[model samples]
Target: MQGKKFGTFAGVFTPSILTILGVIMYMRLGWVVGNAGLIGAIMIIVLAHVIAISTGLSVSSVATDKKIGAGGVYYILSRSMGIPIGGSIGIALYIGTALSIALYLIGFAESFNGYFGFGLTINDIRLTGTIALLTLTCLALISTSVAIKAQFFILAAIIISIVAIFFGNSNFQPETIQLFSSVDAVPLEVVFAIFFPAVTGFTAGIAMSGDLKDPKESIPKGTLLAIGTGLIIYIGVAVFLAFNVSSEVLRTDYNILMKIALFAPAVLAGIWGATLSSALGGILGGPRILQAMSIDNVTPKIFRKGRGKNNEPVNALFLVFVIAEAGILVGELDVIARVVSMFYLTAYGFINISYFLESWANPDFQPSFKIKSWIGLLGFMACFAVMFKLDMLAMLGAFAIIAGLYIWLQRKEVRLQSNDVWQSVWENVVNKGLKKIDANIDENLNWNPNIILFSGESKHQSYLLELGKTVSGRTGIVTNFKLILDKKNNKPLKKVDQIVRDDTFAELGIFARQVKVDNIYNGITNIATTYGFSGVEPNTIMMGWPKGLENSTEYSKMTETLLHLDYNLLYLDFDRKKKFGKYQTVDFWWRETDSKNAEMMLNIARFIIASPNWNKTKIRVLFVNNNNVNQEIISSKIRELVEDLRVLVDIEIINNAVEQKPFYTIIEEYSEKTDLTVVGIPNYKIEKQAEFVLKTNHLFETIGSTLLVKAANNFNVLDLDFIEIK
Candidate 1:
């Protein structure tokens, strides 16, 4: 494994071509021609090769584009597509390759018994296969290069056998050829599945990419040549069988080619050679895949161990032997063939997907042998369709197994030291979506709050970010900017962004950002005026409640600036001493003049209850009606609004005109035991912050944790879920 020994022909083409013209050609081609006539069989041949050639193109494109890591397809995919998906597919490819050994041996044993057995049965074939697996496993454990040397002789036998079969005499059968066969044979899809494994050997070379002198040049050249060579031989044999042999005989005899060849011994030698060579190829390839997976921590560490100076994967080879033995015990070539086909198809599909996404996502991916991304997509689609056609239940079960493995790998956090395409893909999607969206949205019909946080209190940053998430209700976004009051105005914006860009703040759709300013008041004003885009701009400014009357004047001025910009102001009066006790009750105080605030407050209340802590908490809408309105009438009006908003609330209407207790007094009596209370800031003159703060401070003293909301627009209360009041 450590030596630079193989050139293009020995490394890639010889092994690949040997496997492609293998067990299926000797044992199953006549059956396929019988089940589907000449035209139908040719269609199957062409269709299967389309996937192969497409996958080949994708493989070439990826291989030539970059310097893929060692470990063949596994390394290429893990580097290009990320590890979890790569490991999932890599494991499948290894199993497929290992199980294929059993399939070839089963064919060999059947052919051997037909030529020399004294009326032996399936049991005899199984015995022969076990012997063959042991012999091949020993050869592999001894020296892998011996297997490569053997393939040259195997290739010669296969060519001679093809020549013998072509010249062999068959019973006159000009009338046997038909466009389609009778329903007596198995379904067309079944025939296709049985024949599908023949084309899969095209990738046999890709698994040995690490051994190539220049994989970039050798891989594409050798792989494409093998596929082309296999295609010509396959279609030639299919047409010959259709025209020379009678359909009834073709249907009945699995080894009709070997029986009717010009020199039966030569054909038998070819059959033996093809089957053994393919098994040998699998033996040589499967362990390498497992070994790669082990070294990458995708599998256990023990399988990564090797023997001798060449570092042969002796442990992984034993595992392959075990799986191949189990496959042999299954004792049905068609069953084994179908399993092999499904596995190969699954891996091939993902390979194309990886290539397709990588080409589009990575702008630097310019391959000398570039193929259209549509070709890769086409390959993916064809594989998917063929898998379902082969066996619907089997296809679903295979996908489920692969998906389960992928999930397990993800949980293990299989980190590869490479970049994946997801970030670029997501950015492209977002950029396209943003460019396509209109700036002006119908506010009443479809809107969600985009909150901008400019809080002065650093200790409550996490709380404010979480609150933004809760209020957005998954339909909006949040941006938290920790305003660093740099009176010197010395910090650059690059470092400013770095200031608040902690990984923790970006959770739950919040964008963590920072800015430097001379004062909190001017910073909020300038940032709010400039932040965000036109369509999804920030319409709400969230800030912690002012701590003392010392800065009430500046806070009041900032509040006026936001109001003038037509933005809603939500001041969180979070009580650290009694932080949102039990989240049991939400009281939204309402009045006629505070109708707009009532809408925003109701939206916030709905968002609060959606949180896990408050999901079961009920909303209690408490209205203080001052116009001497009838209690029941006010209750019905508010009830209609809540019902239209599709939310549940207990309506409590108090006719303050009858017993006009102060607003703070009413809160002290009813909301003293509540977990959270919502109130609105009354409209006042810009210079009257001292008067406003004095009353608001007392209200907070009377209530528990509270949100003081002031809306700048008269938005409909019923459309709180959709509308944004900016």
Candidate 2:
């Protein structure tokens, strides 16, 4: 196996075929037939085979398209999807594969004990299983090549057993062979689930990909042939059992085939051989998955440690031993079967989806052995529905664990330097979206605050991204940019992409962008003007409050440049001392003279309320009327603003009766206690730049967390209220 490259037969055909005609076939098939009758059992077998074939076809297509490495399915997935998704699937596949050891060892012990033990206890059976596990683990650890050679004997045993089943005679007369056995039977889906693990062994050969001489050719050829051969054997055996064996015996005896065989000893040997071989397949396959993941930097580095000239994964093999023993501890064959089925079904579903998405999204996904993409889609849908039908909670738990692993991988800094179909998938989606938006550019549409912020460093400025997210809520988009000043970027493009990825706060959906720009203003201008196309363009720009007039001139000029670009501006003067304190009260400063600014300010507050963190927050429409001028009119105007805003908010007017002080003084005295305050920036104040900076800075100098908004339009909110209804 080390120096010589095995071809289709020894490499793929033997392992796959032997494993397919394995534990499930020997131990569980009779029980399945008894519960589901002849026709229903055939349907289950056929359905399971269909999924297996679809998945095999998918693996074949992808294998043909790329030069897969040691990880087999893990390698294919990591290359097709990102490492996170692939790693998650790989972990689950490894567990399922390792647990197959338990499933088979239990089956083996059951058959071995029943034949040899003159009425052995269940504990005795478990002990037999443990001994088998220990022996197999030692064999696998010593030499995988020797393990491959040993399968020859196992295959012969399986062949003899299969012959015995067909040629044997049983004295026990079976009841009428009903197409549909309607007597107290379990659900078809449950039987299907139990039987599905049988056909899932088709991937056994695939896991031996690294040792194959021509994986592209052998994989598809060997795998498809194995599936076809297994289907034939399963159908033949099911039909023969329906005719030759008693329904009562089939229902009661787990090893009914042994009783009705041409030679009971041959059938028993076949059961033992099949179970051992399948367990060995898992022992060989599961560790390699861990080795692959370890190599990919997802798992612990020690699992990648190999021994001998062939580079066997010694550490990973031992890890599989532990996991397998854990699975065996459950002791119930049916329970083990159900759990293994869920894991494999999830893997099969993802395999189908990976193929479907890759073929459709990418033109380079042309394989020599190309099949219909819809087959993969159909397989995915079928697996998904079947898993839920079998056991919704189990399926959900499996998926949840996968998701948990995915998230954990996502948070890790192990960036895989490989291309995935996701980029193409997103490109296809964006292309269609841009076309639609282009077609409807002239039509009036609802506004979404797609904001871009010049956040300095992601590690330090999470609060900025947080505020920006609140500004947009779930309906809007936020791109947090960190500009690295470098006229001539001496770093490689790959390193730059990595840097950007490192800077990104991807969990919040706001992937941070770190760009090397010669000039800050020019970079920002280019990004702002051309960052996005059609409706996704940044309509709003946000900046953190400048500290003590440092770079105030640059900040002011940048603000003016962007403001003139017709972009709505928000300057968050975040109070780190009181970070969104209490989320109790938010004050919206309302003024008729600067009504447009007021609308934007009010909307920002409303969007903040929409955030789960601030959903319970109450809004106050604060009207600053310090002079004793039109007190009643001011109250009515504030109420009208609330009505026009259409958001439920309390109105607070600070007239002469309430606070006999200047407007600026009154803001500090009354509004300083509010949680989040939205203040309007008027046009005239902005015209006088220095005064505007001084006054605005002075305004929020004593306030808590705050938003300073300047709307792009001179539109009246009072009038837009009527237009909103019409």
Candidate 3:
């Protein structure tokens, strides 16, 4: 899927057409100083090229990495620093895309007004902008493949118009060589302003670098080519206008291309074509950044949800258009442009800073293309220089948005971490701690062997009957049988609760009692903790070892909690009914070394042997030999300790005659005949060995036929709260 998509993107967005026109228009210079006066038009062109090369170099240096994503330059910058910085850059990129959309719409409206006397009011302009936005939105709603194809057509029209404009006006040159002299008419400030717009499209090509075939080679070539083409077009137009047309005519209107189009038939078509092409470009690129940001969790997840048939982020594209229409309503093109520049500048400044910092910190962080560190330094300065051009209110508004987002993210991250930590701490302090208290009380007071049955609405209910007949003390069964009603779903909680109650009552007859709780797992833990704290610990906690689902985190955590509370767990491993009258072979696998929690497993094993089923089952203890002298000594001690049970059970210690992995050997030899295998819980540690044992499939897979026993320090059997049987 990934390979196919890349192929399509590569074919459509390679920098072939864009490079030719990127530097030509000098829109910025024209906008600032209509004709560039006659003095600095040449200088402005030269300076624009210099700026273009430097900016392209900066971008390419970062783009060389194969890991670059849709966020393009911004993603690279943020990842190099950290999430906080990356998140800030992400916001800037989104704003930049949005502002570009607005700029395109403004240009679109102006050009349409010039060509067709639509007599658009401020509201009418806004409506038209909205319409344009919706059109683009629909285009974007289609798959990415369709959008790229559309861009190809837009590029084609732009190239054709540009070619005609230049060819048609070629014959209209001035006579005198002196006519080619530098324009003194254009002001430096005006020239700079005009040159700014030309630079806008240079970065447009780089925006799709993530979607490019090879960003490193492609971005540099495409960016340079685009800027070069744009430069030539701008200079040619400026030169033609300076000699053939008067400065008075240029000053009257900022649309030099449209003005030229009036006299020369070819120029008019080119003017319209360029405007439409630029507008389409904005539409094609904007929603992609939004989709990328959404996937990264910097924005709402819905924006990153499944794409429509056209492979576009339909929801995001719709949103961009809606916002663009709002911008058109205001009809303040300068405001929109400045804001756009401000956002891009902020993002670019950070990118430069991040690169500089990363280079300083890591010696290995070199790119294929090297820009003198000074270029990035200059890039930083350039961004700040442009940023200051924005009005105080706009700057303040931008800052406020950034600050608000940062605060919200920080709070959310803190809350999530805190919740996880609190859960862990609470389970240890209450559940495990209370069980110890119950154990101490039970030791002092004479109490019958209490049996706690964990059952649900399943076939495992027969164990309850067997326990009822054998146990001579207080017996209680617990199950997670409740209907949770969501108010948003418009379901009555009382009705839902009644249904659950009726169903559970019907299943268990009069013997079983249902306990209603908010969350099943937490409820069970809470009840067990309460009972243990009250000094009433059950002798045996009878529950089925829910087969096929032991790998789940919830089950593991619950099992760990039970082990920690020192509950003698009765894990009924019955998958189907078998002859109950005959005794079956039971295999016990015990490790040599004893840890602090080892007693929990041993106690549970003893309780299982004491069960009614134990009388019908033959128990065999198989001890694997550990070579470590100290471990072997501990195993010997454990062996002597269990010798008292030899009268009632068969015990054997396997010696290491052949050296091999103990776990593998034990499972290979005894698993075939064993009805049930018993193993001890692992001691939790931060070391690699412990982690390997916990995560590896060897133990889990081998112990499939076995019931795992983990020892706990603070838990007592009396605290067992049975939650479910099925």
TM-scores, all candidates, are 0.88, 0.79, 0.51
Better of 1 and 2 by TM-score: 1
Shift of residue 154 alpha carbon in model 2, Å? 3.4
The global C-alpha lDDT for each of the candidates, from Candidate 1 onward, is 0.81, 0.80, 0.53
lDDT of 3 by residue, 477-550 (tens): 33223323243534334533343344434443323334555555654565555543254445445555454553
Clashes of each: 1, 1, 36
lDDT of 2 by residue, 130-246 (tens): 899999989988788888899999899889988988898877667688576666877777777778778888888888887788999999999999999999999999999888876
- Candidate 2 versus truth, CA RMSD in Å, comes to 5.6
Per-residue lDDT tens digits of candidate 1, residues 341-452? 7778988898888789888778767889978899989999999999988787767767877888899999999886667766666767776677766444666753378888
Ranking by lDDT: 1, 2, 3
Clashing pairs in 2: 168-262
Question: Per-residue error at 10 for model 1, in Å?
Answer: 2.8
> What stretches of model 1 exceed 4 Å from their correct place?
118-127, 134-146, 172-176, 300-315, 329-340, 438-445, 454-465, 481-536, 564-566, 629-644, 658-664, 712-726
